[model samples]
Target: MTTKSSLNAAPRRFALINDRIITAPKEVVPVSVLRALASIAADQVLVRDHGSPNDMVLDDRATVDLNDGNVFYTRARCDATPPAACGSPAKLAFAVDDTFELSTAAELPFEAFMALFGLEAGKQLFRDFESPNDQPVAPGSVLRFKDGPVFYTRGGQHHDARVEITIDGVKHKVAPGKTSGADLKKIGNVPLADELIQNIGGKLTPLADDATLCIAGGEEFVSHPRCGASS
Candidate 1:
């Protein structure tokens, strides 16, 4: 159970691939390896453990893990002064059983990959899913083969996964679950007097401020000034 005081007292923090200051919803979270690495381009990432000498690398990942009460930084695995994509990408595709949703690059770090077959648990990433099973690879080892790192599950739990959404014309990631209309407004910072419109199947639908949304991921939203107050 999260309280406002809890969020205020301790905010889990990390930086986006664009270096945006992001607040984590949990103390420690598991992120999708495919998405994380893709956030950065041209190179692999090295994750420095929050206040320790240990470091982790991402072979194809551009994202980093978020830990509560800690801050982590990402670096490249290459010898280049600023780091650049030195190794070629390996094709990686993942799915819940056979319903593959995301197809991406390769040879990602172990810590970088999120499993139980879901990115994380609380956000309802995959229903009843735990974590990804252990593989023969080590955390620091590289598995850049040309084939598939493709994933599958026995009982499909690929419900609403985290997806990319557009708020006010800017793309943002939306975690799947019961969403409040206010939450969407906060995502795009829509004003109290403004309105949010959802474009679905080429149809324009006005979203209510009190509505609850079950996001299917990859949805688009637009904001505009309210025409008039509701009767």
Candidate 2:
């Protein structure tokens, strides 16, 4: 006769982030969430197969599979140039749901840029205005118009696609592609995104009620309704 297995099964191993090992029944978890679990900071955290070269750096979309031995290791990464340099290409890429996306490349076609914003190719897209320096993007490009600036319409108002940055207690709006050390200087004197994170004493995961939340797409700050104590 056949027998049924017990319902209380053991949790499966997911993947290792840094020295910590994560095990869960779920098949996948966002890299950002995993970094938080391992106490590692954002953007620079590199996840790779347990033992592999730097070329295998896993993006935010990497998944941990229990059946395939998808073990991983996480470490902070750095670029050789100083944060104050200008015209540097974005070094990382990430997606924000189906509404928006970002990628790291020296230069991409206008079609490629539109695709990131969920725009259809070969369509009569309505741009707010013609950019002055509109041209093919080059390697090591920043948010300059030569790299094909993106525009969007909201409530019949035109706007450029940009991100948020906080410097010395002041928040500023900046382009998402401009998170590099050089790109950040357009608004104010600020350290590299990674540098700021390191200076803040690594990833902030405290049991206190005044913890900070660092969201993806640069240093933007947003309020989470559930994060605060209710009245």
Cα lDDT computed for each candidate against the true fold = 0.44, 0.37
The digit string of per-residue lDDT tens for model 2 on 118-228 reads 644333322212221112222222322221223333221233344455644567653343133333332344432322321233453222122333323345322222334
Error of 2 at 57 (Å): 1.3
What is the lDDT, from 0 to 100, of the residue 39 in candidate 2? 64
Per TM-score, the best of the predicted structures is 1
Q: In model 1, which regions exceed 4 Å deviation?
A: 1-161, 227-231
lDDT of 1 by residue, 150-226 (tens): 33222223343446778888886655566666678877778867888899988999889888877777778888996
Tell me, by lDDT, which candidate is best: 1
List TM-scores for all candidates, in order.
Answer: 0.32, 0.27
